[model samples]
Target: MNQPARVLRMSYLVASLAGVGFFVLSVAWLGVWPARRLAEDAKRTGPGHVVALTPSEARGRVIYAREGCAYCHTQQVRFTQADIARFGAPTLAWETRADTPHMMGTRRIGPDLARAGGTRSEDWHLTHLYAPRSVVPASVMPPYRHLFAGGSDAPRQEARDLVAYLETLGRARELAGDEGEARAATVSHTHMEGLTPSPVLNPHPARPRRTGEVPALPANGDRARGEWLYARNCAACHGSTLEGNGPGAGGLTPRPTNLAEHTYTDGRLAQALWNGVSGTAMPAWRDLPLADLGALVEYVRDPRITSQLRHDRTRPAQGELAFGQRVYEANCAQCHGAQGAGDGWAARALAVAPTNFRVQRLWGTAAMRILQTGIEGTMMASWRSRLSGEEMQAVAEYIVQLYRDEQDLRAREGRR
Candidate 1:
């Protein structure tokens, strides 16, 4: 019995020692070793060097954490098929090497922020931060209005800093180019080694890729349904009146098309809705049913059917027209084309093509506004400094007359 008691005591001691040894091993293997490896890897991997956050970016990161932006937005792109399909290649471990706490958020209440940089213009961000609904009528994300001093047009220093920080989010990865991506693929867990990665990962991956072919429209469309759809989707950017003066229009570069004045072929509408306009903030609505898209097109083609409208009914006074004609010849003809066809000598060089005034009927007041403020995101510059109010009004009136002349000429030719 005493010998048995001695054996039991010895076994108890051995067990305690074994437990202690296991704890030490776990700490070294699971904690210390991994941390050291990560540190070393940070020094070597990613664009071949560590990407230290700039002072402004660091401050912005602090703000991002404090604001709980991570609660809604995720920074990590997982290895799952869905994530890879949507966010481009799987995120490498070394990609977050410079991140101190890391912004790999737990949930995705909003879109991923991993590839947000350079996807949108600065103005779009400013307006969005000020009032999400202003630009995206259906956005569930809350606005960061406090970031602005007054209007979206006038952002405070903090706002600028925040945007600057935002602009840096996916910049390094994009700047990494193909070589950096290839280097990362070799060491990353996802085994994306050797294959060339897409140069620019899409920020809004929910949108369909451009297929170059317009989706087919339904055989027949309901104008009423199209009206409702237009109000829901197009009105925020294109304006409720189709005048291109929506609350969000002011912020967009290449301001939203004045749909009422601009005539588009059915094919152009289909293509724009299906693939979105490149180099613009317009998003593809491929998720919508074909019938809905057809209706949207129908409604956009003739918005006047659903609602009563008001326009300047009075024709341009002859003196006003004569003065406008003189102004058009001297100043506007070079860019607007002699016949207002948007085929001016300089039109070829412009990124966003000039407006063809002959095809569409512009609101006189809207034309004056364009002259005063200039269309943002295009070659058009504000004439506020160059022309007097009377001259601006005269030129705007002349532009309206161009459409009238074209319509009258077409009517006469048809009769003949």
Candidate 2:
């Protein structure tokens, strides 16, 4: 070969060798680093730390692995503002240290499952698994009812196990003792970018006349009546205490709302009872007697009853104005205009425009009805399927309160 050609070949050979060296170094370092770090974390966190799983929970893990749940659900959390904002904090490195086969799953066919534990009560999950559309009207998830033998005991056991496994997630922070203050602080300061004022807060909030005060029961609104009604009509899903812990909670998406955290007025409560929140698991109680429905509403709204069930009635940040502004900003700003007007980015894309909350009637007679129906004639969809009856009521009340406050502010300004 000529000298120039030989030199060129020599240089090419050197460069190729250097490239090989770099690849080898990378492979070795990358392979070892994560394994070593994971080991160290495991050592610090310990393994075989029992998480109080029932036999069903253990079985459910087998099913979860067998079904390739990892394909669609990732147990790990990513560190992103949107993710943290939407699904709480990112996964901690040491939290999964004890996992024999780490559940840092791949894909996101559904929301992340890292924080599934206690995020919802058990019954919600069961209903979801049986029929995804029954609970989340918009879900594309397939039903898993075939896993059970047409409502036999076998599926129930498997469901319990799955729930047990899910319940173990998100307990890491609680285990670490940072849950109380950290969670509370996060909730307190978390700002939602765009939400509209609720109509319930209007000074001239539409006050629908009550059909009647719930008459005192012949047996003084017997607890037995509530219990019987709960077991026969409600317990299959909402647990004994209306805490959303019934047998059906496991399979649901967004899950059932815990009823113990809500307070509702008689009128608002009556509306839900009379007309079920459309597009959800809560069917209309139209078939029920008005008196029975009224009693049920009272049972649900009674502070004593709620307190007995461990319900939370803490008001949102402030009076309707402040809270409604925050709610509108955080939840509505993206779809609705930034100014509580209906001009949003997706407005044109949608079949219908979001309502202008500033309008009196929009925040008046139809406010609760609209919310109950969700965004009509479009993909905005009803929240009824996702939120519980009590939650819907609370949100409705909050909206009216907001409308009232705005009107009051306007009135004060006029006087000035």
Candidate 3:
């Protein structure tokens, strides 16, 4: 062999060995060493330590990845003012220490899932997964209907596991409680980009606080604007006809309000939008402008008052009316009041006050169903066992007549 050929061969051998050495060092420092450190630290059982996932939650995590939920939802809350304000404190390193292949997704087509642990009830999550639009009118999320056995209410084991996994996200950090917050505040690293950590971390502002005060509605709203707002934001759940038969209505338990059948006071409408109904999928729309809020209220009221005012055409026989009156006095009067003004003796004792029959209307079929099934999540109970079908029909008709009388009186008062 020539001298130049031998030199080239020698250089190639040296280069190959150097490349192999670099690879080994990189693996040790970047891959093995960090993993060992993480394993040691993650086993910690201190106040700020991430809790080990239960067997069910671990299984759920697998399901979450299998379903490709990570493609749309991110488990990380970025270190920014907007993120902190919207989704609590920024995610810490320990928060994701337990995840094998981290679920910090690449994109965010939906809201961040980092602090979704206690934001909503399990039922709400199940319903949302089964049919996203059922609660969120404009949600673009695809339905996971296959996860359910029958309906949104009936989720199979995988569905339950998936929900269980979701319930674990950011839970450990929250479970850390006030001490964790104080610890985080004391840590120099917690302050980022000159941003101070919030004293109280509110993971979910959308969840309702149990306050009794009702929000006030804006006055003299423009109906045209209100109509536009309603079509854009509310029509999917409330229906174009304001009948609560919107495309997404069927999956919800207790269902959407039959806007055409009921008269809601301005305060009720305003408060419902502002705070969202607790134990339901309704979300708070605090981001909406004051004018828009007023407009929505006006739009909701206009159709009910002008076009959809239900006057009970069913005049029951005298015997039926007498029987209905007798049943109402015996059973419903304690909660509905003698005059149906929602001021019965039992009203104060109930969490949700009874509906004033004088101000509210119910369709015959709906009233019948209420008599049979009762209103879930309310003080109302099924009277199907106590009242015969005929009695239920008569009482419903009597209630409808009461609504008609009240409507007439209101109209007369407006004219005067």
Please identify model 1 stretches exceeding 4 Å from their true place: 1-7, 32-45, 50-52, 188-200, 203-222, 249-255, 274-291, 305-373, 382-416
Best by lDDT: 3
Lowest summed lDDT across 10 adjacent residues in model 2 is found at 199-208
TM-score of each: 0.72, 0.42, 0.69
lDDT of 2 at 220: 26
User: Residue 195 in candidate 1 has what lDDT?
Assistant: 42
Candidate 1 vs candidate 3: which has greater lDDT? 3
Model 3 residue 195 CA deviation (Å) reads 2.2
Candidate 3 stretches with Cα past 4 Å from truth are: 1-52, 133-137, 149-154, 188-190, 196-200, 203-205, 212-216, 305-309, 312-369, 377-379, 387-416
- Model 3 CA lDDT for position 67: 89
Task: Please give the ranking of all candidate structures by TM-score, highest first, separated by commas.
Answer: 1, 3, 2
lDDT of 1 at 327: 83
RMSD of 2: 20.7
lDDT of predicted model 3: 0.75
Q: State the lDDT of candidate 3 residue by residue for 1-416, as single tens digits.
A: 99999989899889999999999999999999978765554444226445788898889999899889999999987778787877878776577866789999979999899988867666668878988876676789998988899887788998999999999987888898876666555443524657655544654656653334545667768899999888877776678888777766665655667777665556656777777665555656666787888888788765754343555455788888888888888889899989777789997777555777875667546788788998776788999899988888888877766753444467799999
Per-residue CA lDDT of candidate 1, range 1-416, in tens? 69988889899788999999999999999999989876665544566664677898788888788889899999987766567656776666677766779988989988788777765667778888888898878999888878887788778877777877788877777777778766655566435444445334553532433345676898458888988888888888888888778988776777677778554545556767887655566667766788998988888766774233436558878999899988887888778898887778987777555666775556536677789888777778999998888888888888876764444466799999
* Model 2 misplaced stretches (Cα beyond 4 Å): 1-24, 37-55, 152-154, 179-416
Higher-scoring candidate on TM-score, 1 or 2: 1
- Quick one: ranking by lDDT, best first? 3, 1, 2
